[model samples]
Structures are given as structure tokens and as C-alpha cells.
Target: VLGLGNVGPLAGKPVMEGKALLFKRFADIDAFDIEVQARDAGHLIDVVAAIAPGFGGINLEDIAAPVCFEVEETLQAMLDIPVFHDDQHGTAVIVAAALQNALELQGKELGRIKVAIVGAGAAGIAIARMLRALGVADIFLSDLHGVLHSGRRDLTQWHKPFAVAPQDWDLAAMLRGADVVIGVSVRGAIPEAALPMLAPKPVIFALANPDPEIDPAVARRLRPDAIIATGRSDMPNQVNNVLGFPFLFRGALDCRARQINQPMLLAAVDMLARLAREPVPDAVQAAYGLTATQGLAFGPEYIIPKPLDPRLRQRVSGAVTVAARESGVARR
Candidate 1:
């Protein structure tokens, strides 16, 4: 971890520490959360490269936007050890897994859904790419300004490939018939009225931390058949990165992988989706205060495995390790 300044340090310190704790608790993988106050991306890369020899893998926590992409790419190229930006890939894996299960529950296919992702930041871009890898074709990506289309003058290189042709639709208009609406943007961005405009039984992943685009309570009242998820523990089917990153890093480290590649992430997504379909263990049910009648089986509410479920380490790590070897990125 690096960038221990500005919002990065304050927002990222606790998250990195929590991730370290999860790695230790679940997989018996030792991790140390180190914060660096580098002034720029080049300096941060140099600092991390200097210290890379001591660690098996480098997990980039809350480094902001386009800088995070450059840092991860440079470190991956320079170092033999795996360099993973959790904000991008971690959220991507969890969202993919949850979306898979949600589609199954709704009797829909990934290839057939219209996805409207609000927020074209790192997570949103990664999610769109991962979904594309999973066979989702129609993706509508938007930021605060409007939809990301090819005609936009302010488009970045990273956002170019995902951009669609110019359209008259804003976020709300785009949601009119969308099968899935993924929110990685700010709080209360999706109005409650827009919830009813979605296709029937829509999957809403309101993944903004601490707050969501549309409150789950409000969404349920409007579209009772909709499957809702958020980046929150208090809610059911929370699309949390913790559920992905620690186990992912564990697998990468164990395999001595050179990088966390796309195939590895897709494998993790498949494993998570399959894990959700399996019967919930007694211990897991007890941990979440769920009764056999209420939660032992898979359904709309239980789209993704719980964070504390003991089987996650073995399932996700095994899938990722195999993917690393198959993708020719593993050293051992």
C-alpha cells in the first residue's frame, strides 16, 4: 500500500489494515500495511519498487483515478511480484460475482442484459471491462457530465474504448429499460422515481460506500421485484471488495504470480458465482444470524457469499491460482 496523504491516507489506512487483518484471519497469509507519502506517481513507484523485494505482492489501496492506473501498470512492469490496484480489480470481481448470481435469480443471461453504470471512474471502467469479458455487450457508462460517448472532447484514453456513439439520453433516460444499474458514483445520484423506470426485476448494485445512489429501502418500495446490493455490511448482498482482494492477493502470493491478470479475475468471479449456488454452511448461517428456513439456500437475497464464510479462501484462492498458472503469469 502507498499514498498515505490527502483522502488516501485517512480513507485508505483503515481499509488496508482491515484487508491485512482479513488476509491473516482467513487464509493465514501474513500482510503488512505500509503507507508512503510520495509526492507524485513517479516517486510513489520508485518508493514501492525499492521496497518490493521484501514482500510477495504489492496491494495498491486508495490511490486516486488515472494515477492509480499508471502506478499499477508501472509497478507490474518493473517488479516481479504482483501489483494489484484493489479499487479497480477488487470491486470488479465482487460486482461480477454478484451480478452473475443476480442474473441467475432473475432468470436472465449476462449476454442479454442492458447495464447502465453510473460513474466512469476506475471501478466503473473495470466493471464494464469485466462484464464485457463475461459476455455482457450493451453497457452504458456515464459520469456527472453525462454518458461516455465517442464524440465527447474530454474523454481520456482509458475511457475511449468503452465509449459509445453520441446519444440524447442522460443517466435517468438510460435507466428507463436497463436490466442492471451499477452505481459507483456519489450519494443519492439515482432518484427514487428512476427505480420504477428500469426493466422489471432489475438488478441494482448501489455500490457507493457509506451511502448509495438509491437507498435499498426506497428501491424495494418502488420495485419490489428488483434485486438490490450495496457496499454495506448492514444490507443483504453487500458488494464489498473485502470479499475479493484478500483472497485474491493470497492466491497471487501463494503462486508467486508476476501479475494479477484478467483470466485470474474471471476465474475468481466464476468461483464466487458457483459458491453462492452451493448450500450455505451451518456456521455461515449462524454467523449472519440466518436460520435454515431464512438463509441456508441460495436465492435473490443471497446472491453472493458472506465475507465471513470460511469456504471463500479455499474456493476463490484455488480458482485464482489455477488461473495464474494457465494464464502463464505464475512463477511457482
Candidate 2:
């Protein structure tokens, strides 16, 4: 995986070890975590190639964006094994699922959805691309400067293709009348007032770490009819990437997938959204140990499944694996 910091107990090692463990639990897969002493892309590529023979697939984790885009592209070109940057694709899969369920609850369609991504970083770009593939034509991306538009002079190559030209530069302006507003940006970016400007029954995914762009309470108050989610575990609708990565990688490894193409990603999305809407099984309820009221149900507060939901890995992995096989990316 491409990631940050010198190898030590405090830094990137714990996450690597955790991912390795998740790999084992979900698919009996083995992984070696290599700490790149330098943050150089070339260095990471060399190290990955040196250890390529032991693995059937490559799972890239936690590498920052823009640079991550180059890294994923490079590794895919260099290695025979399917190279997947989990931060990008994994997050995309879960967001797609969450968006689908959110839209369904609000009685909206993907084609007409107007999405505003607060952060134009890795996760935001991936989500936008995936949403586009899902038939969302109206996507607006915002960075620290303002919303990315065609007239913006200071746009990066990665943000250029999805730029919404000549729109209001203010973030609040972008949120106005938006059907779906996703916050992958910094914490507390979406103030309480901004939430009220959303279209009725909007879909808001405030997916920043630790603290979200907007508090769930604030969002709920601003538009009670709106469907809101976050990256936090404490939140009711936790839009965690855990819903997809372990399973996505498992499927890719199982099938010896050559590439993680769009069809495979969409398949994973469909399966996860469908699973989220499934009748709560006795096993699932037993695992969570929550009451029928607190167990599995569909609403703004109870959208995505908890991490400990036992059915997640099997359900998501099965769909992704089948998708790979059908798309001819999987060898098995």
C-alpha cells in the first residue's frame, strides 16, 4: 500500500496491520505491509515490484490524493496483479451505496441528482467519478478556494474535468437547491445555515473524519426530511469505507481480477445498497445485540450497516467477485 510517515509503532503500521487482519477475516488473504521510508512514488513502485510475486492483488491504502491518482495509474501499468487504491475505489463503492439508499428514501433519481463534494481531494474525486458513472450529470466540486468551475484560474489537472463552470464561487451558493451534498472536505466546512438551503428531502453525506463538515443534529434540524450520514461510528448512518474495501479486495484477489473497472465497482454498490435494504436476519440482529427497533431498519438514522454487521463482508464480496468474473477482470 502507498502511505505516509516513517515505519514505527505510532504511524502507518497499525493501519497496515489492521488491514492485513481484515483481509484474513474476510477472505483468508495474506498481505505484507511495506513502510516506504520516503514518500516518493518511484520508491513505492520499486518496493511493490520487488515483493509482487507473493501476492495475487495489490491493495493501496491511505496514500494522499492527486499523488494517489498517479500512484494507482503507475502500479496498474507496471504490475500484472490488479492494483487497487482502496481509499479511492473503496470509498467510492460505499458512497455509491449510501447515495442510492439515501435517494431511494427521499424518492429521487440518480440521473437528476445535483451533488456537491466539499473536498476536491482523493475521496471526493473518486465519489464524483463513481456518481457520474451511475448517471449523475450535475456534480459540483469545492476546494479551499471555492467551488471548482470552468472560469477558476487555479484548478489542478485532477479537478479540471469535473469543474462546474461559471457557478457561484461561494460554497453555500453551490449547496443551494442541491439534491445531494457530500462533504469529503475538512471538518465543519458546512455550517448550520448552509444545511437549510438544500432542496427538500436532500441527501447529505458529511464524511470527514473525527468531526464531520456538519453535525448530524444540525443537519437533521435544518432539514428533518433530509437523509444525512457521516464517516463516524457514533453516527446512526455511518458511511464507513469498511463496507466495501475488505470485500472489494477479497473479490479482486479471489477472481485474480486484472483491473478494478467501473462495472465491478457498480456491482459492489448495487449489492451493498440492496443488502442495506434487506430484511434484518436473526444472525445479524444477534451479532449487533440490538433490539428489533435498534436492529436493521431503513431510515435517515439507520441507513448503512455497522462495521460488526457479519453479513457485510460476504454480501459485498460476493457481488464484487461476480462482477469481476462477468467483466472478465477476474481470472477465477
Best by lDDT: 1
Question: Model 2: per-residue lDDT, tens digit, 202-321?
Answer: 988888877788888877877888888888877678887777777777777777888777888898899888877877777777776766766768776776666777777777778888
Candidate 1 on 1-332: residue-level lDDT in tens? 22233565556678678878877887788889888888899999999999999988888877777788889889989988889988899999999999999998899999999999998888988899899998999999999889998889898888888889887868777788999999998788888878878998999999886778888998999999999999888888988787898888888888889889999999999999899999889899999787777765788788999989889998899999999999999999
Candidate 1 stretches with Cα past 4 Å from truth are 1-5, 8-12
TM-score per candidate, in order?
A: 0.95, 0.93
Q: Rate the local accuracy (lDDT) of all candidates.
A: 0.87, 0.81
What are the root-mean-square deviations of the candidates from the true structure over C-alphas? 2.2, 2.4
Candidate 1 overall Cα lDDT vs. reference? 0.87
Instruction: Rate residue 27 of model 1 by lDDT.
Output: 76
Summing lDDT over every window of 10 consecutive residues in candidate 1, give the lowest-scoring window.
1-10
Where model 2 places Cα greater than 4 Å from the true spot, the runs are: 1-10
